[model samples]
Target: MTDTFKHHLELLIACVIYGTVGIYMQQLEDMSIGSIIFYRIFFGLTALLFYLSITRNLGQLALKRKKKYLLLLGILYVLQMFSYYSAIR
Candidate 1:
């Protein structure tokens, strides 16, 4: 396959995995909902940071220049997540 076709295939696989995440999340019976969400976010963030570090893209993020905007986005994201999980439970 060409590079473009390979990238599209990877993206399609990612979407399928992402779409199935909720089904897997519903299988955790022992843990509280909060614990489940915490682990999900923690591991997701860790994976994202690791990817950025491996690709040397951390510097490209330019957090210093975008600190204020990123902070605002972070707050909104937290609020949205809180509402989502709360509603689901």
Candidate 2:
């Protein structure tokens, strides 16, 4: 398969997985929306960290290029998420 095809397929799968998780999040009736979002992010990060550790890629995070660009992107992502949650509420 071509690299472009594989990348698009991966993006599709990621969207499906994210949609599935969002559906499940709505069923947690006892938790506040904030708590649900917190758990979702915490678990997602934990799983990502575990995967990186197992793959020995955790060390590469410190050596990534364009640190300022990445930091800006991270901040933008957080702001986007906050805006999304606010809109949902």
The candidate that achieves the highest TM-score relative to the unseen native structure: 2
lDDT of 2: 0.76
RMSD of candidates 1 onward, in order: 3.1, 2.7
Please list the residue runs of candidate 2 whose C-alpha ends up more than 4 Å from where it truly belongs after superposition.
63-72
Residue range 1-89, candidate 1, lDDT tens digits: 89999999999999898667567657765677668667878998899999999998997766557788888998887777666655555
- Global CA lDDT of candidate 1, please? 0.77
Worst 10 residues of 2 by lDDT: 21-30
Residue range 1-89, candidate 2, lDDT tens digits: 99999999999999998667556655765677667667867998999999999999998668468989888997887677666655554
List residue ranges in candidate 1 displaced over 4 A: 52-62, 82-89
Q: Provide the lDDT at 65 for model 2.
A: 82
- How does each model score on lDDT? 0.77, 0.76
Candidate 1, residue 34: the lDDT equals 68
